[model samples]
Target: MKNKIIAEKSGVIDVVIIGAGAAGLSAALFLVRARRSTIIFDAGSKRISSSKNIHELLGFENKSPEEFHNLGEKEIVKYGGDIRKEKVLKIEAISNNLFAVQSTNSFVTAKTVVIATGLIDVIPEIPGLKEGWGKDIHVCPCFTGYELHNKKVVVFGLQDRIGQLSKFLTAWTNNVTVVTNQPFAPTWIKKLSAVDVQVINSEVASVIRSNGKLKGVITSDGQKISCDAIFVSTSMQASSNLASTLCKVDEFGFAETDAVGQTSRPGLWVIGNANDPIGHLAHAIASGTKVGPMVTDYLLEYSLADLIK
Candidate 1:
């Protein structure tokens, strides 16, 4: 797993952590506490940006995503963790067994790397979706379902998938409607009907938004069903582009990892939604914290081996 250091260590650092979210920042703080010179490279775009408030986080049940990230950044900086607001475009294993991490405008070398870049939600085409997303239009009910009790909720998704929304919606309200842009399987249609869930076969032309809140979805035929919220199905893609070529990723683009966040490739670790698409914020934080000490141990061992050389 070790590569010979054939190239010179021109201006490399101790560790290069790619990402600065809850997971990345948590890892950075721990690494810095371990006295490792850690640098965090953040692209500044994540799946949680569209969310108004992140629930289930203790102490701050209604914390904004930006605030949550900023607080973490402040703490990391207080601990002497360096952060760069740049997009990491590539990470290649170079000569001398070091990793040359390349961003949009810069490159840095490190002994080990932590890829906590998270994931991106694939949004379908619908007018006004940009403004309506994460507001009245959402994907996970567990995140923002408290506001739709007993109200008309539209479940908009693909023909092949309606997901657990149809069933989960019933917990909050009995009034739930499923709308697939294309005709869905009769099996799903019948199953939904069995539970008193109405299924609509119509393509959406545009989403109706007022003041950045979702009103409803307008169909191609000029028909509109007024609803309090739209539970749209979104496909989650992992943000592992920088390490995908250097590591092992599944068909869904999520990097495969061991129990301690080590990827298939040595000296590289992955955590959070980057490795687990369905993982929550708590899971991401826990994963990052868990890997921090392990990364420190790795760098220490790596340096020890170098000393014997």
Candidate 2:
């Protein structure tokens, strides 16, 4: 299918941004402020929506993930940037600094593209884990660990190296139990035990809930390990598959980008979790804010050259 080119009475759109999470919306805000035409495509289902409290976002530290996303949409629209809830199926480079982006219903030709699709978390296969995630089980200790401070916590991960990761939560709670499903745990067992951490040598079968709240985790052998919170050592992968099809990725599973979010491919840039798997909310906004001006300058030059012709 041919990619549809969106044009307005003034001229063609300056940039096309994928994903409306922090990065995408921040970029749009900057671009529109510069009077550059921009469009944002967001598939929704952003992982942050699962988070009850969006951590470390300055000023709105107490805002929920859903509320933050809504505010971002409003900010983008207020500045005259078009925000669409559509999934980008594919992006094709047509010519110099020009490409075609296709979605389920529509497509658009853009002078430049910014990818901020973020990441998808790989949750473990324990029964009830999916349902309890973000509420009882968490990947980031800082997100919910504070709430469970001084409470019983069970830390579970597939690797033995998770022993070290579990130790960090000691600041939040002293009652830390490291559950390594592997029969033979890692050599770091001595260091962990020295700190009074309990090492459980069993695989978790499911998350047990009592009256809609987290109770504990049940082991494969039917042992119930009581805990108030479960901290998961996330084995994260970037949401960079689409970007990888266009450019190379780093060893860390993130797309290689410059200091300002420009990718290896000209006219393409990556931001947020798609560029770095461990990027927090602040990093996403910073990267997008930096890239927005650069894209605006590039489009300005392109438009001036067009006028000369």
What is residue 214's positional error in candidate 2, in angstroms?
A: 1.5
lDDT per model, in order? 0.80, 0.80
Residue-level lDDT of model 1, residues 178-225, one tens digit each, is 876566566766667777788777767788877776678888888898
lDDT score of residue 268 within candidate 2: 88
lDDT of 2: 0.80
Q: Tens digits of per-residue lDDT for model 2 on 1-309? A: 122233566444678899998888888889878877788998878868877787777887878888888988887787777888889999988865687888866778888899999987888887778887787788877666678788998888857446776777887888998877665345576667776788888878889987778889998888899988888876777764678778888654678888888888877889888876767888888888999889988887887887998
Best by TM-score: 2
TM-score of 2: 0.89
Error of 1 at 177 (Å): 0.6
